[model samples]
Target: MKNQQDHIHIFSGEIADYWIEDGILFSQSKPIKRTVPLIQENIELVKKITQNQAMPLLIYLCKSPVPDKETRQFSREQLSQVYKAMAMVSAPGLSQLIMKMVFQFQKPPIPIKSFSREESALQWLQQFK
Candidate 1:
């Protein structure tokens, strides 16, 4: 059987690709404004990639929240919709129940495995890779 690391590959270009390195999930840029359209675009992208046998994952490496927010949690109105999207993708084991539980919490105290250096993220992602 191929190790997770052996399955890792990069396809950098106009269309983004998904892959895991260590334990971190990585993906290309999703559009701004966390809107339905933008989210749908990402979902389509995930579907297209997964159809090709690539696992879908997201790794956010940002010094601050994209909107400069104090926390990573989405706003109150965004929670339900986000949950729905996650549920829609759970069929093929794309989204795990633990992830769902983490997101489902009113205030998930779970610390996002973040790192100050790309190397650190890379090292962590290696576990899953």
Candidate 2:
């Protein structure tokens, strides 16, 4: 898959494409419904890439349809299982709002933060590496 980042592509799911660089696992989601199976694919691929070790995640939030409640819960519960922390990269306004809106009712299972720039996200994620 084509990416703005200069990292080797690792996996491409229905919802997200993944790659790894400098101990951070990066994902850029497509504008599609993120399903449970797709999220499972995401976890399995990340586990393989990290060799079962917990690595920090960096995801670029996009205009994907909000996942169903069950899928959202599953994604939340599996966060600590696959990643030590997560950094979400989004533009300064609505995407960030949508991201938070999706998970606002519950605290994240791991460290989660949002940034407007990939550089900032990577810089913040370095602490977890």
Candidate 3:
């Protein structure tokens, strides 16, 4: 069972719980230190969810431990493999701070944005659909 919103529960991945609605992929990230193997598992789940089609992703924010270099590299290289664009919905400033750090290290291969409200994030993700 899940919170009502007509959400389709897809899977409870190693890193997140996934669902899809409105042509967008949604994830509630787990507070876990993402690893290369875990991210790989997530990629497989995502491909299966979208039937090998990349689509916009909306991630609910969680405080995850910083990943290791190998894990980070793998995650960055594989993002475009499953997501065309990404929208992170979080409380004010949290996503912004994290994104700033990510940009400083390396620009994401796909368009990404952060919003404080799920409605706004979903509205923005609609453009990519």
* Predicted model with the maximum TM-score: 3
Tens-place lDDT per residue, model 1, 58-98, is: 44321211331322243333333322111111123322333
Each prediction's RMSD over C-alphas, in Å, is 10.9, 2.5, 2.2
Off by over 4 Å in 3: 5-7
Whole-model Cα lDDT per candidate? 0.38, 0.80, 0.84
* The 10-residue segment with the lowest total lDDT in model 2: 1-10
lDDT per residue, candidate 3, 26-66, as tens digits?
A: 89988999888898888999899889999999999888898
Deviation in Å, model 3, residue 39 alpha carbon: 0.6
Clashes per candidate, residues 3 or more apart or on different chains: 11, 0, 0
lDDT for 84 in candidate 3 is: 90
Top candidate by lDDT: 3
- Which should have the higher TM-score, number 1 or number 3? 3
* Candidate 2 regions with alpha-carbon error over 4 angstroms: 1-9
Instruction: Tell me how far the alpha carbon of residue 93 in candidate 3 is from the true structure, in angstroms, after superposition.
Output: 2.5
Taking all chains together, each candidate's TM-score versus the true structure is 0.39, 0.85, 0.90
